[model samples]
Each structure stands twice: as structure tokens, then as C-alpha cells.
Target chain A: MNKDSISKMITIHGVNGISLLNSENEALLSNIKDQQISEAFVFLSSVMPDLEALLAMGAVKQVMLKGAGQQNLSTFAHKKNTLCIQSDPLLSATLLGQQIRSAIG
Target chain B: MKSILTNTISLKDDEDSYLFHEGECLEFSSTKEQADQLSEVALFFDQFFSALRDSDLLYTESHIEVDHALIIANILKNGHILLTITNTAPHAHSNLQHKRPIIQTPRSLVSNKTPSKPLDKKPTALSESAQLAIKKILINYLGPASTIIFNDVYSKWGALEQPTEKSRANLLKLLAEELYTQDEKIKFQAKAEVILKKY
Candidate 1:
């Protein structure tokens, strides 16, 4: 959806940062400031194109990554942009994944 | 702020692009069934350790298994791969009143009684069909670079050559074993093909 919906749909309580990257892995929208958090997303964003390429090639159905610690990242790749969420790890990534999926689908 | 050392997983290619990353919080799962749901942790580390060997990041191929999880940590350029397998289920330890047989990874499934034929050719690029099959299996977890990783592993195995039904079947089995997929159709197809070749 629009810029505001991202905040409306995806909860950012314990989330360190969020970056809405384009197919080029460039952040079209983000609120990451801490250098580590910023570096993390930047490093994470770099893989969006290949993800898109995978989707383009009719490969996987979905792409998600659970990082170490309490942080987890769910990437919803699209033709235009990739929604990457850096949030607290949850019991089931299904809920957060669905929210981001529907919000950006 | 305290850093949560929750189960972690990372996938970075030789080109230095991290396709998947989940490292932010410090909370542990409170459920048992959901414990094994760490797709992020499982997929990344499995490949990360495997990648080290392919990229020559490690002196030799290595892996670790504690309980149901596997870990492969390596010291690379900027960051070292730290893969730790933790059992989140409270019952994982308690419920195991009786001893269970150990599980083996495909890499460890090396058979001793040699093949019918002798070694002849070096590892080559995976056949197009095999690549296509593995791409479909690995793309979800690995993304587009699945092709690249596939090539690397294929060449390393020295499994590639004039494509024979036996070799193709053998390659597919190896892949199916390494990559975790929930889809039964894919699993069934792999098994069926392998059996057909054997028969």
C-alpha cells in the first residue's frame, strides 16, 4: 500500500528498523538510524533482486529469514519493491508475514 | 540494551550480498511445535557452512549437529559464520525418555560399498534439467543465486558428466536431502524418480 499503511499494518514496537527497498536493493523508504541496524538492513536489502529474479524464474513461493537473537526479518518481494521487516522474533512468523504480505500484496 | 542470542541464521554469497538476514531481537520461543519453525535460522546456517567449503572459506567441509539442529561456523572476511542448533521445545529433552536413533545429514550418508562403476570424470556443471529441478527446490530458501550455489555444489561433487539416469537420480537425492521443503509433491517426485532409476 502507501507509506502510512506500513506503519498502520506492521507493528514496530520492538522493531529496530524497517526498510522498504526497491528491486535494485536501494531503500525507497526506511527509518533505520543506528549504524548496526542500518548496516544490517543495507546488507539485507542487497539480496532483493535475486529474490525477485527467483520469483521471476518461477522458483520459490515465498522468502523469509529468521536471524539470530530476538531479531527476525521477513521479506515480501514484488515486481516493484521488497518489504523487509526487522522485528522481534515471534512464536510464529505466520502472523507478521501475513500482515506484511497483505499490506504489500 | 541486552542482545538476544536467539537462534541465528545468515546467508551471504561470495559476491558479498546477503539474500536473507534475521538478527535483531533477544526473545526465545515459548511453544514446542513452533520451535522448529525457524526457517530463517535453519536455511541460512545450513547453506552458510556449506558455502564456506564451496568458496574455499574453510580448509575442509565441516558441520555440527546438536539435538535436531545443525550448525556450521566459519571465519570469513568481515564476519564469521556462527551456526548453533538449539532445541526450543521444553519437552525436547524431557519427552525423550527413551533413546532415539541418530539422524544423518546427506553429506554424512556416504556409503562404503563403492559404486558399480569406477571413478572416471571430474565434476562438471549440473545438467540443465537438474539445475531447473534444484532451482525449484532451492529458490525459495536461497533465491536466484540457487543456480550459482547449485553449480558450485554440483561441480564439487564431481557428479556432473554425460547425464545418465543413475547420476541424475543420485544428484536429485543429494539435493532433496540437503534442502528442507514442506511440499510433499517435490519430495514424492524425488523419491519416485530415484526408485524408477534403481528399478
Candidate 2:
């Protein structure tokens, strides 16, 4: 609706496809990779407790298992969709999660 | 002759300081490392007990002779647990380690009723049409926007993944009931229940 609706490049992934919503609520970038991954997140999110528990246990903040060079996978959920955010590493993941939540709202 | 396959197991209470393990083995208190591992095991059993308490769950006293070991259980009390892993001794009668009953009958070992077939068939999940019916019910209960959420749930719980084909009907009913009860108002649960009975 407005420029502030999605200031950053936002992609709302559903079970079917990924919708990259622009500032005007338009899908300027979109595709569907694997539907199974999103469905798995939905199932797991229903049965899990807050991620804060892991955080409180002093779990690793950002766990990145590097493959050869650039291939990285963030291991574990969400109706559930995953935001494949090309996030700024310097920025807080928590803050990014908050932003994503607000955008969904 | 006590088969060398048989050994002793012990359970111990480590909830407090200086508690000894009591079972069929020599009594000894746990070291700090042992105590830590035991604590986690206690939590594990607690979760299992909680899950089984209300269900039609039952167990009989028996040992699992896996490989070369005979497992045994200990009494659980006052946040204490004990497990004894007994290893079958070498040069013992290997047949003594395990025994399985075998009954040979002509046609019907069971009652004269028709024999049930083995459960070797692939699971029969909800047909796409059946899934759509449930989706339609959900849409009516909530809103169209819920398709996204339902689709997500569908991805997670594809009806075809059920191990037993017979339970597919009941599973769909359970899923519908869960969705309704989880979000419906307390006053509306009865109505929702009535609606879900159609499934």
C-alpha cells in the first residue's frame, strides 16, 4: 500500500510458491523451490515451544556449516513459510525476525 | 544352571547427595558425570511416562537380549532411576540368550473368524478430493485467507503418509477437530464438535 510496507526485499513463502512483495505489495521477485520444506516447517512449528528456550540455553547465535565455499544452510518453521532472507550479517537476526513478523502482520 | 546370558541390573536414586543405586548389582553412588547422564535419563523417562499415563498403554517385565546384552529396568521413585545393562558371558549357550514362541497350525491359528491380512500394503491417504472437502470446511469455519495456512498444514501432514490405511478416516477427523478446538471460542466448541461429526 505504501513505500514503508516493505522497505526491504521481502518474500512471503507459502506452500505453493514464493511471493516477493515489493513496497507496493507487488511480487517483483517470486519462485517456488521445494514445497516440502515449507510443509515441514508448518508441522514442526505446531509441535515446538518457543525458540527462546534454545537462546536462553546459550545456543549458537548463527550456526553456519560451510560447504565448499558459499553454500550455507540454516538448520531449523512456520502456516509455515521460511523467509529466505539474504540478511545483513552485521544486523541482529532477532531484529530481522521481528521485521519479518511485522511484514507478515 | 543360571544361563551365563543372565546378569544383574541396578537402579539408583541420585536426586540427593549420597544416594546409592539399588537393583541386582553391587550398590554404589554415582559420580558427578554419571549423575549428570542419569539426570537426563530421568527426564527422558518422565516425558515418556507423562505421554503414556492417560493412554491405554501397558508393559510387561521382560528383558531385551540385543546382540550380547540383556537389558533390565529398575523402579522409578522420588526422581531416581536405575538401569542395568547386563552382558551375556562368552562361551555361554547362545540359544539361552533369546527365545521366541512358534505355533504351527494347519489353517487358522486364531478363532474361526476370517483371518486378517498382514499390514504390508502402502498407506492409503486422503484423496485430493477428500482433502479439498476438509479445506472447504476449514474455509467456511475461518476465511479464504486460511487457505495459505491450511496449505502449509497440508504440506506438513499429507494425509497419504499414514502408516495404516484404516486410520486415515479417523486421522482426518482428528485433524479437523484439532483445528477447530485450537482456535474456536469456548462457547463455539460444542457447535464445532457437532459440525466435525459429519467427517
Candidate 3:
């Protein structure tokens, strides 16, 4: 995705920031620079492959983490990269996942 | 707790489901036809919880939507992670399918009984009555797994030939650490202190 589309996504209500990280966990394109979020994404990326193989389910498409407050992080698999969306608590993670899937298609 | 799981199913209006804690199946209905699916999802959740715990994050809940179902994991009051799955039609909209589940089997089927050990070998410093009382209090905070965890901690605490006040306090500290938050730990310690005083 281009910078324009990525910028548009952040403007959506409840969306705070967006980042795209490659397999190596290096940010290919990221608007947010929080180290904790980056570290979480990297950890997720490292374990997701093994988790998929052990679970015997198809590749995991999306994961959403909700903190005790209004902080939420949702991750989606996009081609060879991972799209990490930081959003306010009101955003429906499932709906966000679906929207990203449709956009990528 | 069966009631908690039942309440969740009612609230979600969903299909057959099970609850898991640390990769172990804590409870499930007998009519479950999705054992394989549930097991795979549970294993995935075990790893997910571990990742979050290791990160020292403040996450209270998590969601993973894969294949045709949504798996939701919540951190329980006892600092344990519990996961439940809700089935949905493939490619369906965000609205979840609300099929009423079959009647759940009695929890007795799954067995919560702790294996009995020889009384002679057990620790006597902690009286039997006190042990039972402490276990009862734990049930409120730790739920069904209280018996197992209580028995485990009791073994160590009982090993002392003449338990000092400091050692007794240490035992309570260990149990309190199992609670989810500082507030919970404080509350549990207060209640536990009341019972231990008589012993």
C-alpha cells in the first residue's frame, strides 16, 4: 500500500496509528514509533509460524489485543508483511480485520 | 466456573464451547463435536498468553479470528488465562451466528477431585481444619483449580518442623501472588489472614 492509503486509514475513527513490518520485524512503513508496540509485533511475527503449524489451522489472519483501558492493537497478515493497527477501544477489531482484507483484495 | 462459562454462552448466544487454562481443558460440554477445532485453538491461545505474559503488558483480553470461528481469551481474576470459541458462518458478516448450544454435561463428569494421599505422610503443622478452611476461601478467588493449587502450596508450607510466624506469612504471600492484580492480592490476603489466625 502507498503512503496515501496508509494515511487515510489513520484518519478513520478510533484508529491512532498504523505500521507495516516485514518478516524481519523492521518497519517497512510505519507512522507510529512506539518501541513497545514494535516489540510486540516482532514477538508475534516470530511465534505465529510455529503456532500455525502446531494448531494445524490455516494461517492465522488476524489477532487483536485489548488492554485494561482504551488501548487496543490489531494485527493483520498482508502479503509478506504484517499490518499493525493501533486504535481506541471503541473500534471493533473484527470489523477492522474485515475492512483490511477487503482493501487488500 | 460452569456458571461463568454458561453465562458467556448465553450472552454470546453461541454453539458448543469449552474453557481452557494454561493449555489444559478446564471444562467442556459432552455434546461438543468440535474437539479438534477447540484443541487447536486452545493450544494457540496457550502460546498467545505466554507471549503476552512475557511482554509484561497490561492486556486484559485478546481475540483471534481464524478460519470460521472467533477465539476470545480473557485474563481471569486469578492471573490465569481462559479462552472460549464462538462459531460463525464462513465469510459471514460481523454479526455472529447465535445457535443455542446443547445442554451442558454436569461438571462431575470432568472430575474436580484431587487425588488422595496417605494421611501419615502429609504435613501436620497446618491442621486439617485450617487447610480445608483455606481451600474454601481460595475457591472464591481461584475457582475450581483452588484445590489443586492449595494442596500444592500446603505441601511446602507443612514441611516446616515448627512453622515460624515468618514462614507462615511467606505461605500466604505465595498464594496471594496468584491473584491477578495488586487490589486482588490485598483483598485475598485480608481474608486469608482471618482464617489462619484461628489455626
Candidate number with the higher lDDT (1 or 3): 3
What lDDT is reached at residue A4 by model 1?
A: 67
The residue-level lDDT of candidate 1 at B42 comes to: 28
TM-score winner:
3
- Predicted candidate 1 versus true structure: per-residue lDDT over A8-101, tens digit per residue: 5546454556677775556787876655544444433443333323223232223344533535544555556766666666523546645665
Residue lDDT tens for model 1, B1-199: 3212222332221111111123211122222212223323323443433432343223221222222422333333323333333332356555543433222222223355222221112343343223443454555554444555555556545645555545665555555555556574376456546444433
Best lDDT among the predictions, by candidate number: 3
Ten-residue region with minimum lDDT total, candidate 1 chain A: A52-61
Order of quality (TM-score)? 3, 1, 2
Give the CAPRI rating of model 3.
Answer: acceptable
Model 2 stretches astray by more than 4 angstroms:
A1-105, B1-31, B58-65, B75-79, B89-180, B183-199
- Ranked by DockQ from best down, the candidates are 3, 1, 2
Residue-wise lDDT of candidate 2 within B79-113, one digit each (tens)? 23344433344634454334321212212233553
Worst 10 residues of 1 chain B by lDDT: B11-20
Candidate 2 per-residue C-alpha lDDT over A1-99 given as tens digits, one digit per residue, 9 for 90 to 100: 224534433442312233333322223444534443233223222212212121122221221111122122221122222333333334333354455
Give the C-alpha lDDT of model 2: 0.32
Where in model 1 is the C-alpha error above 4 Å? A10-16, A48-63, B1-110, B113-199
In candidate 3, stretches whose alpha carbon ends up further than 4 angstroms from where it belongs are B8-14, B30-44, B90-99, B102-107, B110-199
All models, DockQ values? Answer: 0.09, 0.01, 0.28
Residue B111 lDDT (model 1): 50
